[model samples]
Target: MLKFFYEEIDFKVPQSLKTSKWLKNISLSEGYKLGDLNYIFCSDDYLLEINKQYLEHDYYTDIITFDNSEEEGKLEGDIYVSIDRVKDNAINIGVSFDIELRRVLVHGLLHLIGFEDSDDDLKQQMRAKEDECLLLY
Candidate 1:
């Protein structure tokens, strides 16, 4: 199941039902089943605190994903998204807010599905996957 929540913010995800089905299909396409995935939208400050406290990183990022999958072929996790960053990034990258937001949302799911962007090559691959997934949006 995919769920959406908010913290220190009041934003509603548009077309949530369609988005959930799209995400479930993406998970299945990647050879995994979608489990209890939670997307928490919050302000940059809220996310920064989470970063500093949980990740030991005192920086703001678009999204921070916590993988809680117990085994292979199952995707379960908490995806914390900074709405402030997403809006800024959307303007900086010259993309629509909706497009950028969906990209970040799926980017977190990609991480839970065993994709990483720690290196340039891996990042490129991850971006490609994100783009591919975005086509379904």
Candidate 2:
């Protein structure tokens, strides 16, 4: 199941049903089943605190994914997204807000599906996979 929440932000995610279907498809395409996945949209400060407390990082990022998969081929986790960052990223990347937001959403799910972007090659592969998944949107 995919759930959406807002923290320290009043923004509403558009097209909830459609986005859910796309996310479920993302899981299935990767040979995994969707589990308890949560997407939390929050302000940059809120996410920064989460980063400092949970990840021990001081920088603000667009999204922070927490892996909670319990078994093989099961995708479960909490994806914390900074709305402020997303807006800035959208302008910087020359994409619309919805497009950047959806990309970040899929990016988090890809991490739960055992995809990592820790290196250049992996980042490229991850981006490619994200593009493929975004097409489903």
lDDT against the true structure, per candidate, is 0.94, 0.93
**RMSD score of candidate 1 (Å):** 0.8
Off by over 4 Å in 1: none
- TM-scores of all predicted structures: 0.97, 0.97
Q: Write the per-residue lDDT of candidate 2 for residues 13-50, one digit (tens) a residue.
A: 99999999999987898799988999999999999999
- Looking at model 1, the pairs that clash are none
> lDDT: which candidate is best?
1
Candidate 2 residue pairs that clash: none
Over the stretch 28-75, how does candidate 1's per-residue lDDT look in tens digits? 988999778999999999999999999999899999999999977889
